[model samples]
Each structure stands twice: as C-alpha cells, then as structure tokens.
Target: MVERSHKPGPISATTASSLPQAQVNVSDDNSKVTATIPSGDTVEVLLYGATIISWKSNGTENFWVSDAAKLDGSKPVRGGVPVVFPVFGPPPKNHATSSLPQHGFARNSRWEYLGKSTSESASDDSVKMDFGLYSAGLSEEAKKAWPYDFGLVYSVTLTKGELSTILTVRNEGKEGFDFNVLLHTYLRIKDISTTTISGLLGTSYVDKVLDARESTESNSDLRITGETDRVYKSLAQDTTTVVENGSPRFDVVRKNFRDTVIWNPWTEKAKGMGDFEPKTGWREMLCVEVGSVAEWVRVEEGESWEAGQTIKSLV
Candidate 1:
C-alpha cells in the first residue's frame, strides 16, 4: 500500500482511483490496497510486497499475517518478504556473486516501478503492478563480471485475495545467457515444530544439508523437524508443498520448473544467517522456493522466457 510512484515526490491521491473502471479502493491506508473494484469488496494489490499482502471477503480469507516484513536494507532483514533472482543459492567461492550474497541478486537490488493498472476477476477486483530489474543499467565494472544482458520483470496482481506473480525474463541484447533463478519466499507460519508440510513427502529430493558438508546423492521426500535443505527435482504440475496444521492448508503451487528448494536452518545454522533474527524468528517462517536449479534458463538473443508461482490460502 506504500506509494508506488516512480517519481521522487509525494504520492498522488488520485493514482489508485484513476485507474480503469474495474479498479476501486477498499483501503483506509494508502500502504494497504492500491486498486479495487467498484464494489470495494476485492482489492487489486499491495505493491510494497508486489505481494498481495492480504485479502478477505465473503467469509473466505487471505492474509500475510506472519510478520514476514519486506527486505529494504543493505543487509538482509532477519525475516520478511525477499525477492530472489539472477542466480539462486550460494555461488562458488570464485564466482561473480560470491560476495556475501544469498539466494541471488534481485533481493539485493532495487526494482523500478513501471506503472499501475486494473482488471476484472472472478474475485471481482483485480489490480496489477509491474516491477522490473535489468542488467544494462549496472555499472560497467559489474557488467564485466556477470556479463548477461538480461531484464527481469515481475507483474504482481491481486484479485479476490489471491496473489499471482508472473515473471518475465528477457535477453535484452544479441547474446545468450544462463543463470539459476528462484523466488526465495519465506511465508510466515504458526510454528515450525507443529507445522507439517504435505505433498512433498515420498517425493525424491537432493539433500543440500548433507551436500553442503559432503557429496552424496539424495532422492527422498522432505519431512523436516529440525535443520533441512534440499532441492526436489522433476516435480509434476500438480505437485504442491502444503504446510498444514489442523483442517486448513496453505499450498505453495509450483509450475513450469524442475526444482523445489526446502530450507530450514535450525539452531547454529539459524544464528549464522546473514540477517536472520536468532532470538525468536526461525520457527515462524518457512522458505519454499520455486526455482530452476536443476538447470539454467537459457535466453537467446532478444528473446524472453516466463515462470511464476501462486500462493493460495485454503483454510
């Protein structure tokens, strides 16, 4: 709900209401809902999270209740909404991104606001915000190191309380490029020990926890009670990572990809996180990343590719 103007001045009051007819406002705080339908029942989105932070109507519900704040510092925040791109996971010691970075460069970079718009949805009110990041704008020195003429655009929209993200990757130049990409999302949960993730059980995965310390072949379903890290490969479209407690279930549906990185660094590992809060934070969140770690996405000259994820609340 924060001001999303690309200009460097005060936010325009008419920005949200000025959108298309399908858009309206159902929010008191400008930092909450951006666009809405005429009925004011459904909201378009919350740009700060590009992240449909929360949505509720007609007895159904959706909300980012966990204190998963946004990542807005040079140092990563202990817990929050962090964007990941360009590369995923730890880079080689001599790699270009080996400079104290985690889950790639997007979260570490600033995204430019393109504009705003509205749409009609079954949920009634749908709003869309476009955000982009590019390699062309980087410094000459930076280009020399990670040479890839790339442009990543994320179109985040909210309708009927569901947050849908459409990611587009373009090879902005006359060259091919490859990189591991992921949306390193940490969704807040009630408790780590009490929460049980379904759908992934019995599925095969490459254990990163053991891989980080030694080399081995891991092909197993991920059910973690403590420290865990793994990338599940060759997953089916219906495949889902469901975090459940009692009756309701929150599903992280992954698509058009071949890797699912499940991570939870408990105890010592939690304390060692770059910006993680060791005191009372580790258990309230779960990192289930939608990624392309099995292989790199290759974009040809002047072409583009797309991938996305949908975070749905089914309580």
Candidate 2:
C-alpha cells in the first residue's frame, strides 16, 4: 500500500520559458494528466469525457473501471466517473425526447484539454486541471438534437487523500435552458454485499427496481440485499459514507448537487451486461453517484451553474 504523507508543501512544477508547465502525457486518442501531491497521493485523469480512471493512495486503488470497458471511443467507458450531462437515464417525456441520446453526449464526446495548475487555497497543495466542451464543436447530429449554445468546463483536483471534480456549465444561448447532470461514480470495494451506506436516513428515494416507486429510507446505514437502484431526492446533507465490513471506506461529499444515487446491479443484471467482465464483477463494485438529478435545473441566458463532488478515503 502507498503511504500518504501529512507534510505540507507543494510539489515542484516543471518549468518552460519561466512558466510552470503541468505534467501531461498524450498517446493516440487519449491524453492523461497525473497529479502528485507532496504526500505522494496521486491521481490520473483521462481526457476522454474528462474521466478520472485511477486514484492511488496508501497503496490501494480507490476507484474502479470495468475490465471489459471499451477505450477506443466507440462508447462511454463502462466504469470510472462518467460525466452525465443535459439528461440522466433515459430520455425525458417530451416531444423532442427522441433527439437526445442516453445520458446525453458528454461522455462519448471529446473534450478540449485546458491544462493544469496548483490550487489557490492556502491550506491546499493539490494540483488542478481543466477541460472544456462547447456546443459549437459538437457534431451536427448532437447540435440538431439540442440546439442551445453552451459551454462546459470540467475541473479536476487531486489533494492529499482526496479527489475532487467540479463542473461548470454556461448557457451561451439567448434563452434559458433546463437540464440534469450527474457524476456516475463507480467505486471499487472488497465485497459489495458487505458494504453499507450511511448518512441517508429519513430521505425519500425513488427505487428504480421497484418500478420507480417512491419510498423513504429509514435505516441509518443502508445495506444491499439484491439488485438495487435508488435515487435519493432533495438531500438534507452533502456527505455520505461507505463502510466495508466494519471499517470506514470512502466519504463522498458534494456541493450544489441535490440528489444521491446508489446502485448495484447484482447477479441478473451483471450477467446481462457485456461490458462488465467475469460475470461476477458486480460483487466488487458499487455506483454511489452524486449529482443534480430528480429535477431539471434552469440556467438563464449568459448565466452559469456550478456543482462538484469530492471523494476522500478513510482507509
């Protein structure tokens, strides 16, 4: 296991022409930026969908990407934290619903690399990077479906024992538009059945497994028995904890995101998925996503909306 250093200091940046140049690597279709803090916690980001594919600290992998996931850009990679924008799940009930694809085009579309920098906060020595996507650069098919002009800037930060992803969306069009977004985070664990999620007590959720029925969570720590798909709407707090066996695992915190989604496909659904390998991959992963789902958020013309989530390891 990699050990995390609690010492305070910033990592030296490589310089070019008296300016600090961020460490980045590009190969073929994907570009990766690695951020290493002074304490040795490291994060690796793939430019494809601004996805965070790897985060290692204290010698353990904190996130999961499917072994059978396609990296050739043919479809959204089945793991990691996929950026779901403009829509979530299936198309909404509307006249123009047929135009938008599942989870919109943010995941499959290529984003422009905006480079990296150090954090401005006095208490932070983390490294941060930015990526952008503009509707003007989208394909004609995507343009025809959602014609509103927009800009999305995704910022990722790697700090000691933590990783943060922030998304900012600007409506450049003349009229206001409404949309939903999510960070579809797939977290790795030793055993899915032994995991318990806390901090959702008294919150009402829509159980997708129960035909989208509304229900309230009464348990302080939720355990998964079978196939589970739930969306906790209008969250009262911004943090949730995932505990494996009797030990704390990860603490997920979010801002400007009103909903939390917990999902585990279990046996039947896992066997039905071609991208999830080994046929028993469901036992090792869980999806604890934080985002603004359940309702559409409206951004006025020339205005922007910001939301973010941070994952901190407890082990």
Candidate 3:
C-alpha cells in the first residue's frame, strides 16, 4: 500500500551549529538542505533537482512526494516542486528544444547551492536561499543535446507565513536560446472531492486530455472529479485559491507567470504511472503549476528573463 503522511514538522532536524542563528541545516551527505523557523515551520530541498521535497506550514505538510519516489539521483524526484525548463513536455520536431528530452534537463541535472541571504528581524523572519545551474556546469552529454550557454538562478524564500519561488534565466553566450519553464507544484489537501479551485473564471484553456482543444471557463470556482490535464492560458487574475469545504486552504499568487496548469491524474491515469506510488495517492494531491508555457520565451544574447510564484497556506 502506498501510504501518505500528514506528519507535523520535519522528520530531519537542522544541523546543530547552524540552528541558533540561521535555523538552516544541510544534510551530512550534502544531498539536501532543510530550513526551519522558530515558529516550527520547515522546508526541505534536494540539490538533485533543487526539488522541494517537503514544505510544512500551519503544522502540516503542504507539498506531496510519492512514497516510492527516487531520491538517489537516479531520476527526477516524483513529487513536490520539480522545475521544468527549456521544454514543458514533448519536444516538437525541428524546434530548438527538439534535441532535448521531455521536460528538458533541469530537473535531472544537479544544481549548486549558492548559499542563503539573511533577513531576520523582530518584525520579519523570512529566509531566502539561491541555487545556480549553468551551461558550463552541465555534463558533456547534456551539452551535446542542446548546446547553449545559459545561467539559471532559482531562489526559494520561506517567510513567516508563506512560501515563494522565483527564477531568473540569463543568456551567457553570444547565441540566443528559446526556453519554457514551469514550476510543477503538487499541493496536498484533505480530499479531492471537497476541494475546489477559485479565481479562474472566463479564462481560456487548452484541454490536453481532450484533443488539446481550447475553451473558456464559465465558473469562478471549479471542482475536479476525474482525470484533468488542462493548461489555463491568459489567466484573468494572478491569484488562484484552493478551497476545501467552505474555507480557503491555500492561495497561489503568481508574478509574471503567464499560464496556470491545473492537473490531476485521477484514478486510471494515476495507476498507470510507475512513479505515482500508492496509486490512490491522487485523491489527496493536486497539481497547480505556474509558468510561461503558452509560448516560448526567447532570451537574446546577453539578456535575461524572470518570473515566479508565491504559495500562501491560508489554513
């Protein structure tokens, strides 16, 4: 059985020497970093994909990871927030990203932790950490697949009340590169049947599961009952909320992210995937991804682009 945990706080504690002042800890194996605040909230990120494996707030885990997720750097981490870059899904023939694999190489490539910036005060207790991935650091195999010198700086900030993820892409070579980025975030909830999405009324979307056709939404709040794979484009607003029962549980606030993807594998699709353990796990997790996926963002030589989203746990 694939069991899920609604565990409170982090299972791993921060290192002893770094706690009193910064409340941040790096794993002994140098594989992951965990940051905690005095309020007992914590977040853990693996350097493998710079994937956020766990994030806890309001004394509950806000992100979901599969019970059988691979953590040995074998493949892309099964859940949490996985960074999709250069390509979103399959690559089109003859396109710049055609030479790359699905979802590009960012999630599978190793990243470097560039350290954290201090910002603790009597009124504010937000911690920010940055990770970097550059063309020069990629493996030769990855370089041969899609050769373009670029730099990616990903920042994760844990505020007293919410969590924010920001990304910056810089062209480091004389040649330009076209890319797409998506923060594939999986949110944990009590029940999919009772959960509803708000703030996407009248927005047009492409139904990936339904012949990839376009249609407009008519509801201000929508519920998911079965398999759903939709790419909501040109969102009417920047904020999307997950409502459970009659109360709001989480608010997804985005910045410069032109698209929102609401997806759930549901029953049948969930069982077909090798990584989605505890097949029934789909009942408790929903993917609300944000990115610039409707069209590719072309970075000119010596130029850069930026975008991000902030998820607030209202519960």
- List the lowest-lDDT window of 10 residues for candidate 2: 16-25
TM-score of 2: 0.89
Candidate 1 local lDDT, 147-190, one digit each (tens) = 77788788766555355677898988877877677766666666
> Which model, 1 or 3, shows the larger lDDT?
3
Q: Which scores greater on TM-score, model 2 or model 3?
A: 3
Q: How high is the CA lDDT of each candidate model? A: 0.60, 0.85, 0.90
In candidate 2, list every pair of residues with a backbone clash: 1-59, 2-58, 2-59
Clash pairs for candidate 3 = none
Compute each candidate's TM-score over C-alphas: 0.73, 0.89, 0.93
Task: Rank the models by TM-score, top first.
Answer: 3, 2, 1
lDDT of 3 by residue, 1-315 (tens): 765686567678555444444478899999998998766678999998899999998689999899989998999988899999989999889997888889999999899999997565556666788999999988897899889999999999998668999999999999988998999999998999999999889999999999999999888889998999999997869999999997999999989999999999999998999989889999999999999999989999999999999999987
Residue 187, candidate 1: alpha-carbon lDDT: 64
Highest lDDT: which candidate? 3
lDDT of 2 by residue, 1-315 (tens): 766787668888645434432244555555666676656677777777777788877778888888898776778888888899888988877724357899888998888888877742335567787889999878899999989899999998887788889999999999888888999999999998799999899999999999999999999999988999999999898999999997889999988899999998999998999998867888998899998889889999999999999999998
What is the overall TM-score of model 3 with all chains considered together? 0.93
lDDT of prediction 3: 0.90
How does residue 94 of candidate 3 score in lDDT? Answer: 94
Kindly report which residue stretches of model 2 are placed more than 4 angstroms away from their true locations once superposed. 1-22, 28-30, 95-98, 119-124
